[model samples]
Target: MSIIAVVGDCTTTTALALAAGWPSGHDAVILEADRTGGSLAAWLGTPASPSLSTIVANSPALGNSPSTAWSAVDAMVRHAPSGTRFIAAPVRSRAASRALSEAGGTLFPLLAQLYEPTIIADIGSYAVADAPSVLFSLASSIVVCHRQDAASAGAATVRLERLAELVQFLATFGVPLTVALIGDRPFGPDEVGQFLTADGQAEIVMHSLPVDDLTAAVFAGRTGVSERRLARLPLIREASALARQVAPAETDRAPDSSRIDQLGSSR
Candidate 1:
């Protein structure tokens, strides 16, 4: 159904939490599209092959249709012990970056075709110059995750400004952009909003995820928390609520002509 790109400073863990907490009746897959690198294979103990690199290597052989693209991607999907399905990126930074660069023009467009399972792409730490712009252009929604601290907020502001510029260039003003604040701190959503909007960036929706290190550790494959217990954690509960809010309903699906045309031209 929908492709939600999660980006910002240190968003891999936050993105994982969102994917794991997706509401019931909806099937979601985490696509580790981090340009820098990915740690899911090592973190979740999943296999290293049949990854993004595999998809990139095999892209030319696949048809341009959505069904064909979905099939190529589905074959590489792997499941973690926690029951989350994900497509891992290469572990090494150079390999990962190279794969993305080689496939940047096509990988996300192929991903855009699928409409069955919702995709939550963990696009860690968006860079204005080198980051793939097509990913943001085609995304149904974008969530910028950051901590409450001053440093993280400052970094998020910079990314948001870059995103504002990209959105303007692509003319994708309809796409929803959200700022998700991680953990508790002295400042709240209002203060965070003020900080983000002070620079006159695009309008952004605000959200928060609780601090639950134990549950996060479980997600990292560092703990033995049971599924039932994990679901009850504050972090999971809030993430589920957030997922419900951001993910579009099945009936609401409709092709945005401008975005589709933009994708064609970008290619």
Candidate 2:
């Protein structure tokens, strides 16, 4: 399995879109590991039980093996009406923080060992001080999402530098970093790339998703919108393309030994 962590200033919709638009025949599970709390339970109408909090509570019982830990995680997985699997996080920020703090040390390493399903972790904002750095060390790829507006771009410039520093420190050089631009406002892909490159993020790859408020609203839990209709929207279409571009190849699934060793030694 591959772990793709989606981090951003505000990327809930981007994460949801990627999971919803994942390529056919490859199972993708969205893990709500956001330390700031989560919205998937409410948006997808799933129960709060069998959540990140639940997983954290049960982690001590998980055997040392990755497969065993994965089995326990699988037991807590919930599905949306659209059939996408996800593990929810607590709605309360304090509870979410505590769960992540308690479970992160053991949870991320176990997740790194799994080799079956693709786990797309919605890691909330990388800008937060309490952001889970361990997940970044283990992810196969990291997608950073931001709006195309000036304010969002400005924030992303700063956060991307911080992310670059973290990745360098973790020695996760083999992991791919992608910048997904949400909406085409005053800035397009070229402009976004230029500014980011000027800010020393030239290594990051860029992708864009169109503004589709109607479809995005449905993802945010608006009732009466059909999934079939959403599939044809620009947002979903771009998300599918983005997924195809970022999904790790089968040959690349195994973690790089040197990188892992470096990460372990540094920790």
Colliding pairs, model 1: none
User: For candidate 1, what is the TM-score?
Assistant: 0.81
Q: Give the per-residue lDDT digits (tens) of candidate 2, residues 109-192.
A: 877887778888888876534544667777888887776455675665664467545434333445777878776665677876
lDDT of 2: 0.71
Stretches of candidate 1 exceeding 4 Å from the true structure? 129-132, 150-174, 199-201, 251-267
RMSD of 2: 9.0
Q: Identify the leading candidate in terms of TM-score.
A: 2
lDDT of 2 at 221: 67
Off by over 4 Å in 2: 128-132, 150-174, 199-202, 251-267
What TM-score fits each model? Answer: 0.81, 0.83
lDDT of 1 by residue, 34-139 (tens): 8778898777777798788998898876678777777877887887755668888898899888787766677677667677688888888765566455567678
Residue 241 of candidate 2: its Cα lDDT? 77
lDDT of 1: 0.69
lDDT of each: 0.69, 0.71
Model 2 pairs whose backbones collide: 1-115, 1-116
